[model samples]
Target: MTFLKRGVPLGIAFLMGVLMAFQYYVPHEHSKAFLELMTRWDKIIAGFAVFIGAYSLFHLHYTRIKRRAAGWGYSFFVFVGAFVTIAFGLYNGGEAFWHDKKEGTMFDWIYMNIQVPAGATIFSILAFFMASAAYRTFRARTVESTVLLVAAIIVMLGRVPVGALISQYIPVAADWIMGVPNLAAKRGILLGVSLGAIATSIKIIFGVERQYLGGGD
Candidate 1:
């Protein structure tokens, strides 16, 4: 059981990880073919994973509703929304199920009218939280923080029309700050993230990271 649950998966992960990593540098036609084949396999597996994920989501809400857990009423809406969406999708705007969905379909209507508006409303609400966070962050408590606050203010003002009326230099300074300092910081962060990802991948390939297998040491 240990071999089946741990050793087999680890070996497979190591083999596949190393193969995929090397595939990027191998300019051979055989390597290209192998990559394409693996890509197709990945998509097929992902298709099955979607169904598994949906089942897991449904079961979670079903259990919540059954146990009458806190916010159980919201679980009912999950079922309602899912079923309605699936039904509309299958209906395919009165066409056959196999046919591709087009505009003016029931599925499109639900997505555009219901889901899009709901998503936009949620995003709009997040603006207030962002503003509150900005207010807390731009307090100018220290020298470094004061510089950050000033830079943020310049960037914000430069983006609007009033700043141009005040002085052309403000916009130029803001543009320079964003194009130079902001870009440099972003690249540094990205480099760190890339290095971290490479380290994690190496760990996974060497079986030093077993958290994905439901065990960690």
Candidate 2:
């Protein structure tokens, strides 16, 4: 058991390293199986980690309520919401909103009315700030600045009813700018992100990322 706690992990790490190193060239059924197994294991682990978050949240809220903190009312609300949600969820046989409407009435109301509107309102506020920032950055103070300013103006007009009446090319230019340049940049970023994720996953699988498993001292 001690050997497994030490030697077996090392052996698995070494094997995984070799397999990953040769995976690109070795496009076989075994490689496909390994990838599928890794994917499902990741999803399973991620699903289980939700319980850890829920437990921590519950403990934090309970402690605040017990100490009669300044925001104890908020903590009480949190406790009530989480407990109600859990109760209804269990009533539905531990599945997602599969039961009748009465079973998940409070859960559905809180989610639809409270959570959704707040999320949308926050997003709307952020988008307003983004547009303001864009306007500040895109002001025409120089020749180069004027070029970006012109592009921005054109794109903005193209997004509305006015540009189409002036010329069809305005919208076409906007589409090219958004589709080609934006897509290229986002694609590069996504590829880098995916590689980083894969590297992080490999580190976790090799026990190099013990923090994820609540193993930091």
Candidate 3:
């Protein structure tokens, strides 16, 4: 049982990871063909993943509703929204389920009128939260924090017409700060992230990282 659950998955991960990593560097026709085949398989696997994710979401909400857990009322909306949207999609604006959905379909109407507005409202609410977080972050308690606050102020001001009215140099300084220092910092962070990802991939390929197998053991 241990071998079937752990060993098999680890072995498969290592083999597939190594093969996919090398596929990029190999210039042979066979390598290209193999990459294409794997790409198709990836899409098929992704389709299955979507179903799995839906099942997991449904199961979670179902359990919450069944238990009458805290905020269980919200779970009811999950089922309602999902069912209504799916029904509208399948109904396909009375064109029959087999027909392709076009612009005037019920699915499109729900997506445009209901989902889009809801999404926009949610983002609008998020702007306030982001402002509050930025306020907290921009406190000039330390030298680094002071520098960050200054840079953020310059960028924000330079983006608006008022900054240009004050002085042309404000915009030039803002552009210089963003184009040079900000870009350099961003590249450094990206380099670190890429190296971390490579290290983690190597660890997984060598079976040193088995968290994906589940459980602390």
Please say which candidate is ahead in lDDT: 1 or 3. 1
Tens digit of per-residue lDDT, candidate 2, span 11-40:
676577666667757789998888788779
Which residue pairs show collisions in model 1? none
List, residue by residue over 1-217, the lDDT tens digit for candidate 1. 8788788999999999999999999999999999999999999999999999999999999999999999999999999999999998998878858987666888989999999999999999998998999987678789999998899889988999888899988899899999999999999999999999999999999999888988442
Candidate no. 3 TM-score:
0.88
Per-candidate TM-score against the hidden true structure: 0.89, 0.62, 0.88
Highest lDDT: give the candidate number. Answer: 1
Q: Please, what are the lDDT tens digits per residue for candidate 3 over residues 123-171?
A: 9999899899998777889998899889988998899999999998889
Candidate that scores best on TM-score: 1
Candidate 1 residue-pair clash tally? 0
Error of 1 at 209 (Å): 1.2
Q: Is candidate 2 or candidate 3 better by TM-score?
A: 3
After superposition on all C-alphas, the RMSD of every candidate to the true structure, in Å, is: 2.2, 5.1, 2.2
To one decimal, what is the Cα RMSD in angstroms of model 3 from the true structure?
2.2
Query: Runs in model 3 with CA error above 4 Å?
Result: 94-101
lDDT on C-alpha atoms for all candidate structures:
0.92, 0.77, 0.92
